[model samples]
Target: MKKHQWMATLLSLICTGLGMFYIGTPGMIIGGMLLMALQGAALFIFFMTLGYLGLIIGPLAIGIHIIGLIIPVLYFSYRSPRKPMFDEKRRRQLSSPWKIVVRTIIGLALFAGSIYAGYTWGSAPFMKTAAEKREVQEAAESYLEQKYNEPFKVTDVDYTWAIGSYNLTAHPEKAPELEFTLSSNDASPPAISNDTYLNQLWGQQLRDRLKPLLDELYPDQAFGEAYVFAGSDTVERDYSRLANNADGDVSQNVRLIVFADLTADNLAQEKERVLELIRRLPSVTVPGETDLTIDYYAADLKTPESVKKVEQDIDDMKGKTSTYSFRVFDISDITSADDIEIRGLE
Candidate 1:
């Protein structure tokens, strides 16, 4: 074999160009290195095209070397098949470099076009849908404030639509109206009479017991009509009713529902009263299992000043009863009277 050919083969085998240096073809050495880079890129693309299993690695290795060898050989054949090898031939006598540059530019332009199209056409609608949710929440909150003379700092909201499947021959003109449905925790319907009445009574009794406890804890705050639910079914029903927007055929939209209300001017006093009530309310004690952290006693007491007193009362109660804990959420800013207008069928 020719000295340059022998060197090219060795360098291509070792990773292109190392053997070319031994043969003394500076031009062929550069071409061999370029071939090696192209071979590596082809192997990577091949793996990506396949499911990326290691099975393709063998074929990729063979294919890459073959292409690398053929390209340089073809270039040499065209340049000077009769040249007495390396030192006599100039490296720059090979193929045009401008072609490679043009192809690279085209590839980059295609990639950028795809990215722009995906952003504008494929992904923009989903972003708009997400933004719509925030707008719906704000609108629902505003509506509640206007309707009930109270601001509903809506803590939560959700919606679900009715589904339908039509037959192949279904009339296209008879399409149903697109309806909106709003659901929330506060708008849950009340349970059947027998399922929750007894528990309701128990809840009231617990509240009665708590009234005196609150009085003892904070003498300044007066306890108002405290609503309590004993059974989970009723509570669940009420919560669901509060959350669901049963109005209109769609029965879905935004539900700015209210859970509790305290008709008192002293927001701080009411908060303290509620907190004391929560702390004093009796709970079903389960031995050796602290996982059942029962804090069912909650009152939506509004106003910052009264809220402080409520916190102080909780601290005092904790000192007296170390085993108990409570979740004091602020529903004070929510006093919406806007009823969740229910459908007759619902």
Candidate 2:
């Protein structure tokens, strides 16, 4: 190859400035040196502990690549006289433009492939259907029991996964929805009639079905009574949500609520559900007269010693707390009550 060709080849190799160095261009060398310095600074920022901050600045990467290109070109332009410095053989070998193009293409392809591999590995689904099936089977076994030595089959056990609960058909067009059952070992029988007993029984069945999922997912939290929205049941509506005060210094304080439907059946089922939920939560306790209270603190900020101190303080002040009493309103006769007047006021 000719000397000029060798110089050109070297120029191409450098992509602009380094190639000019092979041809002995002093200006090109200086420009390449400056570019290298800039690249060095960018590289330092990119690899340093403060790389995150560097990215936010967003200039380091562009500076490095721009310098890489500009330095080589500037070198060739300034050192035009050195173009003839290279041997014919070197020139011929370096002049192969195809080789440079192929290398660039290969480098880009490799970069893209690496990105796709990383995303695929990081986003693969972790949960297996087999494990889910097993969990459902175990839940079914726990929900049923024999009555009077008669075997009971858990007719069906269904699974639904969602962020929150809402009634739905396990299968479309299904009727006579399977209900939840909640039971209690309270020795005294509730003063409930057959009709109310059946309704409460339905609610209980739903509770039983939900127990396993709740126990597994929310180990630290307990659910209160299932406030079902039965038709025209105003009392049930009020019980579903009572006013909560946020301005109090206690973080919580007692508030009295009055409800219109205080039937024996509703009271028994609601009580059973609330009690069962509290029993599931390890440290939670429901003051019988009040529906619920903050009995335990599992907060990250509260240390064990702090919790003990708070508990001791509560115990010491228990006797002086008669000013606050919680009344869970379960009134039965509001729908039938009305004010009556015999004469118009003058």
For residue 324, give model 1's deviation from the true position in Å. 16
Q: Give per-residue CA lDDT, model 2, range 256-296, as digits (tens).
A: 11111223454444344334433443222111122223222
TM-score of each: 0.23, 0.24
- Model 2 TM-score (2 dp): 0.24
Could you give candidate 1's per-residue lDDT for residues 273-310 as a string of tens digits?
Answer: 44433333323111111111122112333245444543
| Residue-level lDDT for 325 in candidate 1 | 27
What candidate 1 gets wrong by more than 4 Å, as runs, is: 1-102, 115-138, 147-280, 283-346
lDDT of 1 at 73: 51
Residues forming the 10-long window of minimal summed lDDT in candidate 2: 336-345
